[model samples]
Target: MKTFNVPIIYRSPLISAIKQQRKQQDKMKKDFTPTRLEFGPLTILLARHFGFCYGVENAIEIAFRTVEENEGKRIFLLSEMIHNPQVNSDLLSRGVRFLMDTSGKQLIPWESLQPEDIVIIPAFGTTLEIEARLESLGIAPLKYNTTCPFVERVWNKAEQIGGKDYTVIVHGKPKHEETRATFSHSRSHTPTIVVKDMEQTHRLAAYIREEAPAEGFYEEFKGQYSEGFDVTKHLGRVGVVNQTTMLASETQAIADYVRQAIQEHYQLPDDRIAERFADTRDTLCYATNDNQTAVTGMLNVEADLAIVVGGYNSSNTSHLVELCEEKLPTYFISSEEKLISPKELLHYDFHNHEELRSSGYLPQKENITLLLTSGASCPDAIVEAVIRKLAGFFGLEHLVDETAAAWA
Candidate 1:
């Protein structure tokens, strides 16, 4: 794996040392166990895989390097460089403005951009229409494009199957930038439709099974299908791809469901199932899978609560919180600043899209055990700060430095 020249502010001496040691011990990355950190009373089980992934590091490196190399010139991002608040704020502080919000709403007019100005495509990429719009403005969209290779892999897979007349079934949040970009790319090659989850997939399968009227498909799947999509014509052959950040297991389940539907509809045998369903294997990135698996592994051990650190809007982070919530109480926070005191803390409820404060988050006990982890875009520095804050509450703050020094 290639590394990026990320800013030092995002780095953590303790985290780097721990990760290096873990990597040395498990070169194959077969272990999903958490790293145990003991501080007399409070013990933290840190997820084996968490924080800045390859795509995020690469995007940050490009954004920062572009700012340094092109001083005095305006640099505009298509949207946020990544989902992390700290990273986006850092870029904003460096005078890198955004032309649109994450939902594709225009913040700045396209006419304001000059031919000499630079526009950066974020890791989530952009829609084909936006790319053409930028081209018309004389700005090269791909020149500073930080689109992750794994995401492009999904697009390539879609195109490959689309060439063979397979209708692409995208598993993702429809309003997501990556999904919009992927839908645009796949629809250009063949018929494409976006399904958010198994519930929506069930609804889509009704049409595939011909149990529902094709005319009702338009009203049921409004804005989810590509232009000129005919459910009757396209549902015969299909393939599944995902947003790369969604739950990998969920994506696989949806694919399995769709394949089974196609099999039942066509009365195809196991060997002949491929005749109806294109075998588009899991499209999730390595980081999302590893992190989610690590959480599952961590849950095997008993714990009081789980603390997930990352931007609230981050899709990967919410899925991490979702996994933890199934097993135990989970708090999603962006930084240590959310720890208002030892007695109370502020946390984001992603389901409700609101922040709420709660008392007695920490269990009243002699010895405490908790789980801690972050998202792909979260900086290790934020995780370290969160650990230090918890340590201070237990009056074992010095032990954190000692542990880091020992790891160092």
Candidate 2:
């Protein structure tokens, strides 16, 4: 809980009430619900945990400081500092350039970099090969490194598990920067493979059961498995870890599936199964856990429609949308601009992976309740903007002023 001086913008009375309720909840070790305020036509339900996470705050602080301290020097980011577009655009406007894109495509030629140029390693971290390349070009990766400590902890766990002579099964999107970094680091220690989801895990289990030909393994997991990975040999002893932001329940299910597959295949009892598969707990970050738990709490209350605010590419934000869509109508929008009107709204449907327009999203009920939450990289100021937009839709902008005045 290292505190940093990050500004939080919100309606003062609402923020104060939320803080008080959080304190009470902490004391009681139970969920706390603040009394709903009369803010015109909409009743906003703020989540207990949302917005910028520790990693995001640390990255922002370090990036802004780099800009302030090294005046006139060209500062290049290894990639987008975080997933949020506004944050990345702001850094770009400040003369920061990106060396690579999210897909690991080189935006700037590595040879162009000089010893004097400052290159900031992103929070997702860079592969060892990339690090070595930077070092060769006289760019010290450690000085401007913003890799999250939690992610590094996962890599360390992978190394420790690998040291025990077990193969590593990483439960995450293979193409994600964090996953790529972890896989590269883990492969150096032991054999590693990435499973995208339960579907892939089921296929892996079938492969472990020897129902599929061993030759298919190479073709099926061509780029995902480490070099010289033999399915028959590697699946014997394995340990499971995950990207820090994966859906918690899904990761647990994948681990359970792998453990059961190994047990049945080897005809080992519960005690003996531990020798083959390490029952590692989930590696999901704290912000993800808290925000997901809070979403569960929000689901206890009935709401007409849910507004999930954050970058569409953000894994945590998409999870929030997933949680909400299971029970209620959910709109995943990046900012207030998506709040086009009470009748129409534009949003990204993560399931379809496309932008869509929905009309008449607001319920006709006299008292409208909204479950509001944002991704870890989202700024609180954007959440405030969303609230103001909703207020304007209801012709209740005065309520925000009143709430601020009450706190003053």
Candidate 3:
């Protein structure tokens, strides 16, 4: 609940006023209902919890502070700071460069890095290999590290489960930076493997039950399991953890499935289940839970469509779009500028990783309703801009200003 000294450009008066009014109305934040902003025929239902989260604000504060404190030194980020393109672009405009892409592809040569050069570890953290590499270069990775504490908590959880002699089964995208970092950390502590979804979990369960051959395990889970991991030995006792940004429900489902699998495989009674399975809650981040829950709340209201704003590569943002798309038409856009016209718009399909043009995105009805929300990494200014653009279509700029003032 702490506020950070982020760049003023990322803030919006309208959004701030609305948030301030809500804070005054509900001090404990027990309300999950969407905030209704009415302007003539257009109604915007803003999620109660969205936009910059604690991890993001912390990263921004540390990143900008690093830039300000070190004026002349070359600055490099291990990867995209927080998955929002605008925020990353802003940092780039300020002379900060990225050493690697989100997929762990090295963009800059490791030989170029020097001990004096300021290197920032992103919110997603980095692999142990990368940390050791930085240390070998005489660069202290922790001094400018902005790795989120919530992520570190997942690693700690994995370590705790490992201490109990349980093989760590991570439910997450294997290629994601957070997952890779977690796998690196957890494998160092114990045998670890990454399962992307229920399908992968089912296959892993087959191996655990001895229905599949060990050779098949090596083939199916290549590069996803820790080195020296023996399927026959390590899969005996398992625990579940996940990338913090994953969908909370899916994580729970996977954990439940794996727990049931272990019980059935060993023919263990209820009391003996703990011997084969380490029962624990899903390690989802707070922002992920709040944002996903807010999306569920937003779905209860009737709306023409939903507009989800965030970086296309953002896992959390894509999940938000998925949640919205399940009930109604949803547009995944990074910026308000994507609202090209009243009749036409450009949006990105996160799954396809391509931009497409859509016609008749807006309804012809006089009374328009839209569910608007953004990912945790998105800036409030971007969400406000989208609202203003939509309001412009209905000539409701004055109404928006008056509403913001009244709320203030």
Candidate 4:
């Protein structure tokens, strides 16, 4: 892991307690079972890895620096700086405005942008069209751009596959900015299409097998396919790529399904199929892989409930919630504010795309355990706040220091 110079804002008493807790946890490492700490009525089991990732940190650093350096100059973001609402809200508070929303809706008119204004591209890279527009305005996109290097790496892989005359089949949410940017970059070299999940991949496979009509492709794919893309021709020799934050297993499954479809259609075996399609491994960021893997490891514990903290619309955060929900009841919350009480909590339902309240969210058992994790863009401070809130509900606020000590 690369070392990040993030500031630690631990409250004094909490810091002391965390240090003590760390000592105890370190001492009991070998024979460690589920340790119970009383915080009023809540029991929390922190995941091994959670909170802000390197790419987010790097983006925040650059965004803040740009704000400080360009005082009195207008600053615009290509999109939400990162998925966390709090982070975007903080940037907005500092006079940074977004040109586009998460779904690629243009909130600020491009015609309004000036040559002197600074535009910071989000961690998710912008489409080539947006880059060109910014350049036309004399605003160098790369000057203040904060696109993650990992995302750029995926684009590079797409280019490499495209150069080999293979169509790029991207496994990601088609509406996502990263997917759009990647698709645009890939289309410069070869035909590209985006698949959101297994269902979409299945439809794509059917199309590849000539079971689906070519005219229906536009309606099914909508805005997902590259301009001038030919469904029949593009699906013949395709390579797989993915959004850097997509579920690792899902991406692999989609790739495998596509590969199989091509083989069957061409009457080719595994060795022959390799000549047409590139076997690219997952493009998920290390933070995403580590956090999701850590959540999986945490879920081995038979917890009564799980809490996944981050912006609801956050892709990587939603994936964490999905992973946790598979094993136990999971609450996808934005902050500690969502923890209303021991019996009630507010959470976002990814399936329905709505925020709903639930009762009996926290079990009242004395030894109840919770699997706690957060999205890549979430801050540890918010996680700490959640711990405090849970402890307060259980009337174990005094144990906060002790718990902090354990972690330290």
Candidate 5:
């Protein structure tokens, strides 16, 4: 992992100290145990892996350097460079404008783009159609592009599998920027369809088994399938890929379900399973895997509650919240400011897509234990602030500095 020279404000002394100590102790980052930071009555258990990932750091470095170097020229991002609000707002404060929203809705008309204006592709990448449009505008999308290499690897994997005469089954949100780009690219080579989760994949299985009428496939899938995609023909032989941010277990379960569906439908033997279901590898992002796994490790310790910090709309963040909510009372908040008090907290429920206030979130016990972690895109400074806020409620703010000094 190469480090970046991001803004200092995003760095956290406490978190950095702990991370540095752990790196010195275990350079490979193979240890999945959570870091314990105890301050008398308050105990914070931090996940082993969290915060800005390699792709995010690379994107941030490129975006910031672009802004610093191209001073006076109009800068436009194809969409959000990343899911973090602070990062996007920093770019906006630096005079960078977004051309479109996450849903591909045009925020600025395409006709307004000038030849000299810099256009930055997001970390999730963009559709080939958008790339062609940029080329037509005489803008080199590649030069200013900050697409994550991990995402590009997914596109390459899809191409490789599609070349083997397999339909691509993308497990992701249909309208997500990453999935849309992947669907556009894979459909160009082979028939591709997007399935949001295990539910949709199960529904797709019915079509494969011929239990559902083929005529209704169009209505059932509607805009999810590729152009000219025939449900009867394309669902025969398939391979699965994902948005790289989905829950790893759910993605694996969907793959297993589809593979079994193919086996049962075609009556294929174990050795001949590849004929119907392409034996493809998992395409989840490394950060997603590590973070999810760290969440599992964090759950090993009994905590009163969990606080997950990230953008409410972030898929990866939402999955973390889901993992925490399964076993404990979890608070999904964008920042520490949402920690209104020890008794009450304001948090976002991604399932309902709303911000709600909760009472008696914190327990009345003298010694409080908490599990704290953030999404791949969240800054460590935000996480530090959250810890400080919680410490403030217990008058243990000094303990943070003491712990950092002792660790250092």
Candidate 6:
């Protein structure tokens, strides 16, 4: 676990102390229990694993460092460095412009990019085509590349399975930059397709079993499948990989469903399963698994509601909100500003893609219990600010400083 020299604005002494103390106490990380921050009337059940992950930290360090190292040069990001709004805004404020949006929509034309201009490949990575396009401009895409190691690991896994003649079935959002990049890389080695969820996986299973017409697969899958992808030929052997930020369990479930389909389609024996289905569980991301499992463990305790902090459009953050919403009232917010007050809160309804204003969000009671966590891309400063805001509601904001000092 290599640490990065992330900007101080993104760090928090209080959260850092809490995390360090927890890490020291649980070296093995077997303890999934939340850290109970007792603040008289407010009991904050901070999740064991949350906030910025290794990949995000690495990206932040690289992006900011690139800015510092290249003062006079024009710098451009292929897309967002990470999903967090604060980090992206910070980069933008520093004059690091984006060439494309998250959906691969071009913001600045490729023709405008000069050979001397610096181009940064974001943490989500870019397609081989995009890489080629950058190279054509005489810009070294790899020099300022900040693609997360875990994402590259997934690509490597996809390539490995593809080399063995297995079609790569990517479990991720179809329009996601990472998935598109992965599809491009995998399709180059072998055929690849993107499945957003189990529903898509089930639809794909029909093709795998030859229960659906091959021509229909083209229309059904549409933009999801690779060019020159023959449903009949490619569906025979497959492997599952995912966008590192996607829900790990759903990816596994899709893989299991696809594997079962392949098993039954070929009527393969126990040991012969690998002949049709490639083992690709290794592609599941460590940070995604840890964050989700930590949420599961955190949910074991009874809390009034959960507050998830992160970018509204963040895939990883949305999944965390989804997990929390299943168990209790969960409010998805980008930062502490969404807290509004004790009685009223503004949160994002990710499913609907809109913000909702809610009253009586904090229960009317003497003592309040809350489960708090953030997405992998969220800054600790944001989480600490959230805690401080919640504490201010009870007039126990001083306790936060006291706790931090004690921990210090």
Best by TM-score: 1
**Runs off by more than 4 Å, candidate 4:** 5-42
For candidate 4, write residues 119-207 as lDDT tens digits.
Answer: 99899988888889889988898898789989999999999989898999999988888898998899999989999999999999999
> Per-candidate TM vs. native?
0.99, 0.95, 0.98, 0.91, 0.98, 0.99
TM-score of 4: 0.91
Better of 4 and 5 by TM-score: 5
Clashing pairs in 2: none
- State the local distance difference test value for candidate 6: 0.92
Query: Candidate 5, 70: how far from true, in Å?
Result: 0.3
Name the lDDT value of residue 198 in candidate 4. 98
Give the per-residue lDDT digits (tens) of candidate 2, residues 82-152.
Answer: 88888898889889999999889999999999999999988887788888998999988789988888889
Return the lDDT, model 2, position 200: 91
Best by lDDT: 1
- Indicate the worst ten consecutive residues by lDDT in candidate 6: 281-290
lDDT of each: 0.94, 0.85, 0.93, 0.83, 0.92, 0.92
Q: Name the regions of candidate 5 deviating beyond 4 angstroms.
A: none
**What alpha-carbon RMSD in Å does predicted model 5 have with respect to the real structure?**
1.1
Q: What is the lDDT for 311 in model 6?
A: 94
Off by over 4 Å in 2: 7-17, 24-37, 404-408
Check candidate 3 and list the clashing pairs: none
Candidate 2 weakest lDDT stretch, 10 residues: 5-14
Per-residue lDDT tens digits for candidate 5, residues 1-408, read 688888888889888888888879878768888999887788999999899888988899999999999999999999999999999999999999999999999999988888999998999999999999999988997898888888988899899999999999999999899999999999999999999988898899999999999998899999999899998899999999999899999999999999999999899999999888887788999999999999999999989999999987788999999999999999999998899988888999888889999999888888889999999999999999999999888888888888778877
